[model samples]
Target: MLNCHDATFLLSQRLERDLSVTERANLRLHVTICRGCTNFERQLPTLGKAARAFASHDPGAEDSSS
Candidate 1:
């Protein structure tokens, strides 16, 4: 029964690993009935993977080349 805004907010926090078990359960319940939220949830793992990849890359490894 969570609104889109709240679901998205919780999802963002969940991505940051800041959500508690209760929050996660609530989000799960919300996504189950909401296609938009379900789609949003599906994107999280990909986003998380991209974030981890970005974080793992060495900043100094970038080279300025023509």
Candidate 2:
């Protein structure tokens, strides 16, 4: 039974496939009942798209891997 706050926190990480089964299940349960979290889920993809666009536009940005 994850709360809205927890759901938002987990949403992106889960989308990245970084969450454990238990955490994913909890987030799913929260999004099932919380409209706000559900909306947040809907908007998550938009954010990812924006981030991808930004990175694509900044090819010369310093690599963080070093």
Candidate 3:
């Protein structure tokens, strides 16, 4: 059984690298039983996109509009 902290950590790590077979299995099982973690997992993609957008944003680009 995975705790919420461990589960969330795994969920975030998954986006950065591949999880081992056991890790995937454990996370899958944890997500099935934990609605909070499940929602967090679902939001990962949107969060990733937002992070990329923020990272790629240039302050100069905004200034160009003025």
Candidate 4:
């Protein structure tokens, strides 16, 4: 059984590195039972995409606020 902190940490870390078999199993179990964690997992991809877009945005490329 994993606490929310541990489960969330695992979720974030999995994006950066490969989780062990046991880690994946534990995280899956935790997210399956935890609604908040489930939502967080589902939102991870969208958040990642948004972050990449923001990072690559050009502040001076165009003036849209007129």
Give each model's clash number.
0, 0, 0, 0
In terms of TM-score, the best-performing candidate is: 3
lDDT of each: 0.84, 0.85, 0.95, 0.94
Candidate 2, residue 29: the lDDT equals: 83
lDDT of 4 by residue, 1-66 (tens): 999999989999999999999999999999999999999889989999999999999987777675
Residues 10-58, candidate 3, lDDT per residue (tens digit)?
9999988999999999999999999999999999999999999999999
Candidate 2 structure quality by residue, lDDT tens digits, 13-46: 7776788889978888888989998998999999
Give the alpha carbon lDDT tens digit for every residue of 1-66 in model 1: 678889988988875677888887888888889999889878988988898899999876676452
Range of the 10 consecutive residues with the lowest summed lDDT in candidate 3: 57-66
Please state the error at residue 64 of candidate 4 in Å: 9.6
Model 3 misplacement above 4 A? 64-66
The top-ranked prediction according to lDDT is 3
TM-scores for candidates 1 onward, in order: 0.59, 0.70, 0.81, 0.79
What's the lDDT for residue 50 in model 3?
Answer: 100
Pairwise TM-score winner, candidates 2 and 3: 3
| Candidate 1 segments whose C-alpha is farther than 4 A from its true place | 12-26, 64-66
Better of 2 and 4 by TM-score: 4
